[model samples]
Target chain A: MSFNPFYILPELILTAGGILVLLAGLSTRKWEAPGKIKPYSPEALALLTLTGALASSLALLWRPEVVKGVSQFGDMIAVDPMAVFFKIVVLACSIFVVFLAADYFQGIRVHRGEFYALLIFATLAASFLSAATDLIMIYLSLEFLSITSYVLVGWLKQDPRSNEASVKYFLYGAVAAAVMVYGMSIFYGLAATTDIAAIHSKLVSYPPDGSPTHIIFLGLLMMMVGFGFKISMAPFHQWAPDTYEGAPTPVTAFLSVASKAAGFAVVLRVLVSVFTPGVVDWTPMIVALSGLTMTVGNLTALPQCNIKRMLAYSSIAQAGYLLLGVAALRLSPLALPAVMLYLFIYLFMNMGAFAVVTMVSARLNSDDIREYSGLAKRSPASAVAMAIFMLSLAGIPPAAGFVGKFYLFAAALQSGDKTLLYLAILAIANTVISVYYYMNVVRYMYFAKPKSDTPLKPSFAMNMVVGFAAAATIIMLISPEPFIQMAKHSAALLTGTP
Target chain B: MIPLEWYLGLSAALFCIGIFAVLSRRNAIGILMGIELMLNAANINLVALARYMHPHILTGQVFAIFIMTVAAAEAAVGLAIVISVYRNAEHINIDKITTMKW
Candidate 1:
């Protein structure tokens, strides 16, 4: 019940920063003036705001109370290692996205200030989402994130494709949200409390004979529809490919990495905290979902010619693999860490790949995979970086994706559950199927004939993002111990032991 | 005083109608209205449950308030995007908004 200001410093900074950036964008002064006494460029200001938030989040990681976990604001928010970990992930992705947007939107006439402000606001929502401990907080923050994303997705108002993408995303998002609220209402009626811990305690106290297991299960299933849509799980993933293909590249990157990561963070929290095994066993359902999501995502990804669309399916498949870790949570201690570790690796590789896409599409004005023919000849640095990202995404050796997938699969196998064992094997088979499409990008980069001999020079910011991501992908493979230990430490949730 | 089960039944019916409208409607605004209906149904459930089950605390009523505020915001953004789409594609029919497909 403590209302400590320190617990929410990062959110406060982001809220103030978003408003400041928006106001700064209203000024008519030359933002790009060299040697100016006071530089007020939206990009610089946005980066500074993100850096401030990132530093505070890092500082929160070392707080004495965080190790044991503490609830603030009447138990609405939980500041724990897991929440801090996801905050760092969201902020890191946002910082990289600012860099990508700076380069992508160069010389464009769009409202740059509003774009950065919305990004900061979206990050704010995600941060709140990861830490929310009440149904009301969760619903509010999740919808906040969705509303900001709908606006961000349609930022390029002149592009018909962007307009269509935003509309489709809004429709699906609104429906999913409404259904989720309905489910939350059911929980409210059952427990008469909005706090997750309270709900769990009340459910546990109910007698076995009189407990409303069927009603609880129904509510749980309905809520899953909302969470499933966020992570782009199968059967609820209809909007992702179309949105990814049509939205601006930087926004696409944010959706794939940051938004999905936030979704998983909240999902893990709710599944572990509120739905204990004594109440209901959710493992079987998650297991079935893991298998179906991967099979559908990988199989559909094979035929996509658009790189963004292909990557959309690839991310969906990655979500499936992440779900395998979730399905094994009760049986094995390794499950939570494995999921976190994979998401950390995914942030780098996915953002790096999208950075390259942003740069190439900015220059070539095309998203078609065929247009990337002989990129090795046109831009050797970018082509090589793209190849590394593609390799990492495919879970090939000497790349971080391999280490991540190995841990995820290992977690499932260590669970000793017959179903999880079969799921690991199915996941391995799906990985094999995934390689063809991942390598197809490589084939176009190096093996295919050149469209022209002119070299494509990526801007400094784009190059830095690509190089940094590529280097991290390879370096994590070489030394994964530190990252693994970090994940293990951050696996601690508010109420449960991992 | 009304019984709690009656209120639950009424809300359930409203929820089903909302879902049906969302699935079957072709107009974008029609779909948005369906979503609003669905949210309102949840609001009714929360308010009714609060009155019947937890009379001491205002948790459910407060929750209903928050949901109403968010639903309004959602409808605003949804309509803005719909208008943007209409300006670009010259129509707001969900079926005709398909410039992208796998």
Candidate 2:
């Protein structure tokens, strides 16, 4: 019944930064000369906001109080360690994304402070999505996230591809959202409460479990339709390739990594927290969907020439692995940790891949795989980073992706679900299919010669993001222990185990 | 003086109409309007159930408010994207916007 504003410090910081950037945009410095030096300007404002968000999220590490479920806004926003941990992850990824966006906007002449403001606004929505424990809150935050993304995907309004991406994304997403809300109403009609914990209690204490199960599953299924659109899971993934390929590269990275991660975060939280496995009649259906999604994503990815579209399919494939984790949600000690770990690892690997795409495109002014024909000779840093991202995405050994996938399959194995094991294997084979396409990019970077002149210089921010994400991708392979430990600790909170 | 089943039936019929709109309309904005109708059906159901069941008045109102907020946000983003696309392609048709086709 009380509001603890401090519990939401990271989101508060980001939202405040959004406001500051909005106000700062109106007060541009004017100079008598053509190009005079204006200190404390655009770059400083963006970097300052990014730094503030990072510091606030990092501050969450020491707040042991919130780890134990400190409620704020009448328990509407929870500040548990799970939320805090993912907030840190989201903040780190957002900071990296904004850094890339800074470079991207400068290059593309979209240096409006509104771009920074929207990035912050989107991050705010992501944080809310992470912390929501009620259907009302989740729906609102999801909309917040979607609208911001719709704008960001269409940031370059003059480009036909950008406009098309935004329109398609918005239309598909609007239908999904409606379906999701109807699903929520179904649950409310059956259970009489929207709070996740209350709904769980209602179901657990209900007389006829079958009746409640039917109603709740309908709600969950409808909700999945919405989230499936967001995360680009198969059958619902028809929007992904177009949107990802058409959006700006920086926004593409955000869409693939942060936005998709946020979508899974909501799915995991709602499914694991509200509806136990017994309540839902379709863990196998989920497992089957996982199998189909990975296979479809990889098989389609193998034959693509446009690098961005290939990555789009590849992202869908990654969504399958996350779906496997969702199917294995209630399986074992490893179940929750595996999903948390995969999401965390995916942040590094996926964003790194987009960084490579962005870097190559910036240098070559093309997103065609052929443009990467001689990246090794021109920019070995990007080439090696691209290779690492590709290998990691393919679930190659000695990388975080492999470790994450192993934990997921091991959890499925622990659950003793034969169908899920089949999914795990199919996912592995899809990884192999993915390897061919990923290596094609690598082959283009190393083997074939560039069809045109390669750039002599890489943008400093691109260099920073690539190097940072590449290092994280490798380092998590070595000391994945600490991150894994944190993930386990966080997941245990949901199960009330640790 | 409509019976409860009739009210529920009307809302369900409205929901079906909304689904029909979504399936048939090629204009992105028209599809968005369909989505709005579907949400409104769900809202109608909420109010009906509240009126019939009468277990809690506050929860239904809160839900209605939340749905409105979601509908508003959806409309804003949906229409903005539609206008942006119309400006670019000079048409509101979803069929012609298949540049990313396989």
Candidate 3:
């Protein structure tokens, strides 16, 4: 097979960009005070790198060959509309996170340069993860993402909370990755190939029988445990709240959006491609897991006093909702697109929520919900944006989250399966229960009187990011035709003429 | 040649022990060692399967190599985080490292 460097242009750029940014961090400025090293303006360089990569991904989308999903490098990586779409998502995430961190690090008094380098590296890993077509590619990319995440989570080395979070995250992640690799080894052993397509064909040719049934099930479950940890699915979600609360808020935002997107991308691709629908059906299992995950996530979130922890739990619930689409993928053609659309909208609303958290925390140096009291009186703009985000998260109309949920529930109902319908109803009940906790933040921001009436002022760049995300969220809700159409097209690339 | 089943059985037993050590151990370094054991179990499976099933191809061996490389990297990072955590708390007990909780 001929190697095509053009197929991996985006990844190459990101890799070069990460190294360059790392080098930039090492170079000292001439005007620095004694004993103080002037940090390089990595935020600007990171933004430039991310934009270039994003442009390349968009260019790849326009290529006719890539539209049809071209396999490159001995079928290890796939270049398709779906891959390009996710690359775009992850790149956008990097851009916004860099924006968040650019302003955030100034407030916290931490080293800013290597932080961008790590973020870029994480983006590179996520792009590979969404495009991996072979078992080796999948495992390598997934581990790359995990290892970077472990470091990034602990970047605030001086903070005990941050260090603690990193340890917990690393311990859980290392074990989960080990279990997942074990499962992949089994598949490779049975099929004598590590390529996902080849494994699918082999499994289809010789389906597992009585004795091997246990191995297949065990393999699938173990692998899901690893993916579940990345996406923060329940029963495997013990690390998320702690990690999110302990880590720097900007890192939390990046993990919540881009990392989760990569996890969903791999989960959707592997389960859809490998299992072939009936050989070893895991939909019923997923349905039950989704229900349990959402219920647990919402119920646990209600008692959280820390805003970051609350958002963490809410993100788990959102993952449960996303999994519902995975459950409906075989039954409804719209499921995958709905999932894609939901993730896109989720990036804005959830990231916007975290952006607000970063801003408030930077000022008050607290992540507690009560610290947001009378935020509307202090910062009307941020207060309104937070309200919109909270409402969007609650799936109220005129916010993009409602439209996202509508399509997802529509997919579930279109399945016409009694169990799926019940799952949809359960999701609706979870949504209603979620409204109270989401609104709890809004209540603190609007109704409660502040201990002091000092006005809060977000920086110019922070305002720009929050405004852009808020406007996009409302605009997507009001006119979702283009975004919905794009998601459907991307979904079709994965599910074959969906 | 020894049966592939024998190799697989040993790997499975090793993996189980690894998991037990990871879950049961309280020291951070002990947990990391457990993770290494689990990774090596997978490495054993990969190498054994490659030799028995596909003697002509080197995919499984290559995968085993990559797993070894990744395990080393993970251990490096894991120990670094452990050392950093210890700097703050003066201890490395996993159970006692609870500064942030629900």
Q: What TM-score does chain A of each model score against the native chain A? A: 0.97, 0.95, 0.96
User: Which one is best on TM-score?
Assistant: 1
**Candidate 2 residue pairs that clash:** none
* TM-score of model number 1: 0.98
Using Cα atoms, each model's DockQ against the true complex is 0.92, 0.75, 0.89
After superposition, candidate 2 runs with Cα above 4 Å error? A28-39
lDDT of 1 by residue, B25-89 (tens): 99999999999999999999999999999899899999999999999899889888988888888
* Residue A450 Cα positional deviation in candidate 1, in Å, after optimal superposition: 1.5
- Give the per-residue lDDT of model 3 (tens digit) for A1-498: 577888899999999999888887665232322121123456667788899999999999788988888988899988999888889888988888887776567645555567788999999999999999899999999999999999999998889999998999999999999999999999988789999888877777764453365667788898898899899988899999999999898899988999999999999988888876645788898999899899999999999999999999999999999999989989999999999999999999998898888888888889999999999999999999999999999999968999999999999999998999999999999999999999999999999989889998888878988999899999999999999999998888788821
Worst 10 residues of 2 chain A by lDDT: A29-38
Error of 3 at A240 (Å): 0.4
Candidate achieving higher TM-score, 1 or 2: 1
Q: Residues A1-498, candidate 1, lDDT per residue (tens digit)?
A: 768888789999999999999988777343442121135777778888999999999998888887778888889988989999999999999999998888777655688788999999999999998898899999999999999999999998989999998988898998998889899999999998999888999888888888899999989988888888888988789899999989889999999988898899889988998889878889999999999999999999999999999999999999999999999988898999999999999999999999999988988998989989999999999999999999999999968999999999999999999999999999999999999999999999999997887889897767888999999999899999999998988885533552
> Residue A374 in candidate 3 has what lDDT?
97
Winner by DockQ: 1
Q: Extract clashing residue pairs from model 1.
A: none
Greater TM-score among 2 and 3 belongs to 3
On lDDT, the stronger of 1 and 2 is 1
TM-score of each: 0.98, 0.95, 0.97
